[model samples]
Target: MKFELLKTSNAYAARAGLIQTDHGPVETPVFMPVGTRGTVKALTNEELISASASIILGNTYHLYLRPGMDVIREGGGLHKFMNWHRPILTDSGGYQVFSLAHMRKIEGDVTTFRSHIDGSLHTLSPEKSMEIQRMLGSDIVMVFDECTPYPCDYATAKESLTRTHRWERLSREAFDATDPLWGHTQALFAIVQGSVYEDLRMESAAYLTNLDFDGYAIGGLAVGEPKAIMYELTGKVCQQLPAEKPRYLMGVGKPEDIIHSIARGVDMMDCVLPTRNARNGTLYTRRGKINIKRAEFSKDFSPLDPECPCPACQNHSKAYLHHLYKTGEITGLRLNSLHNITFFLQLVREARQSIQEGRFSKFYENFCQTYPMEEDHSAKNAASRERRRKS
Candidate 1:
């Protein structure tokens, strides 16, 4: 795999590039839909391709739990097992293990935890994560590093940073020691973790950049931190990373955050918001997000977004969607998901074009003004945090 820098915005740090993979070339400033457990919920591979997704993410922990590595390996790796036929980026699953498991215990270089699925004991070291991703034959593999939680004190953050850097070193060594299962280059990206602390963040970046991994990911943010702090730390760390390599911001959220990260020079991102919210009766539009189940939409027959080229918007109406969602029809989940994914993909595509045209700043401003940023998911985030807390 190789990433070629194509263009940059003169007014901001945004850049347009192309990631050349054996499967296909993924244009930079791209959003990879999350396909945890080896499938993007409610969408088929055809729907994914139709929505213009060049790549999707697979969670290492989830795949390791169900179907097992042996199954994927026997099926000739994830591409064939899932029939994605496109680039796949597998996360190390450190975040999942840390956040979703029970009986978590970090023993030196290895973390032992119970499977959130069946309460079976499992151990994941940096080396083991590399093995899982390698067996899956992912085009891009992330280093196994702990995704620290927000509101962590300096002492805890510092300790977690040290452990993360150590784990990254081990991860690099393991990745270098193995061969890609698919006979194609599998780039390994090191993640930066320091919670919300700026100094530790820069220090982590300074250390990881020297290790010279193929790429870098800004991890451990968007885990209930303030939006402003997330952007600030993202900019700070991006400044320390090698500009030529791809910079991925993990688990990042809303459309506003994506636009802001692009301006801060982030080239890749993945989030569950588009798909998850779609299943929950929420739809993204040019103006803002709207709940299809709202009473006001009961009689409204307009397109979800008249300008959207997605099939849902082109063929379905608000009233119809509302009816499906209200009746708990499965078709509503798939259509809404397809439309939301299309919107996100189109958003980044336009952002890339704007950057190439040297008008990203203008595009960002206009988008910020036009889209509503009134997401009050704090309670939801808190619930997620509580779910992941150690028992």
Candidate 2:
């Protein structure tokens, strides 16, 4: 895998680039729709492709748990198993284990956890995470690193950061020991984790960048921290990372946050926000987000967004979507998923264009003025924090 820097905005930290993978080339400043358990919920591979998705994400923990490695191995890795002929990135399941605090106990170098499925006990170490991802055969594999929680005290944050650095170093060695299960090159990216502490975040970034992984990811953010802090730390880390490789910010997606993160120099991001909120009856538009379940749209025969080119808007009316979601029709979920994913893809595409044209500053200002978010936006992210795995 290789990333070519094509352009960078003079007015902002934003950049437009290309990531050449064995499966395909992924345009940078891209948003990957989360396809946990090998499928993006409420949408098929073809539908996702139609939504302008160049790549998608896979959850190592959930897939490792449900179908088991035997199933995926027998099915010929994730691409053949899911029939997605595009580049795929798989997290090392560290974040999933972090989220399983209730069922997991962290020993020095490993975590012993009970499965959320059947309460079956399993052991996961950095080496073991590399093994799991090897079998999954993703195009890009994220290194295992502990994700520190928000509101963490100084002592705990420092301790977690120390442990995370060790884990990532170990992950690097383990990754080197393995070969790609399929014939494709699997690039390993190191994750920088230090909670909300700036000095620690800087330390973590410096440490991981030294490891010289194929790429770098900013983790442990958007987990209830103020949006301001998230963007600030993201910029700080981006400054420390090498400009030659890709930089990915994990589990951050709101439309506004996407552009903000791009302006911070994040090359890629993956989040479940689009599909999850779509399933919950929310639709994103250039104007703003709207809940279709509201009764006022019952007889309002109009597209979800007149400007959207998604099938949901191109063909169906808001009243029909309102009815479908209100009456629990599955089609509602599919169409909503399609439209929301399309909006996100279109957003990044336009952002890339703006960066290349050196108009990203103007583009961002216009976007902020047009997409007026009035609701408590953090509510969705807060709720999503519980279910966070990879995206």
**Backbone clashes counted, model 2:** 0
What lDDT tens digits, residue by residue, belong to model 2 across residues 1-391? 9999999988788999999999999998999999989999989999888888999999999999989999999999999999999999999999999888889999998989999999999988999999999999999999888887765679999999898888888898999987998888999999998898899989988888777889999999987877888889999999999999899999987998888999989999989999999999999998889999999999989888988899999999999999999999999999999999999999999999998888988998898888885444555665576566436
For all candidates in order, the CA lDDT equals 0.91, 0.91
Residue 121 of candidate 2: its Cα lDDT? 97
The TM-score that candidate 2 achieves is 0.96
Off by over 4 Å in 1: 375-391
Tens-digit lDDT string for candidate 1 (287-379): 989999899988898899998999999998999999999999999999999999999999999999999888888999999888888755655
TM for every model, in the order presented, reads 0.96, 0.96
Cand. 1 Cα-lDDT: 0.91
Candidate 2: minimum summed lDDT over ten consecutive residues — where? 373-382
Model 1: colliding residue pairs: none
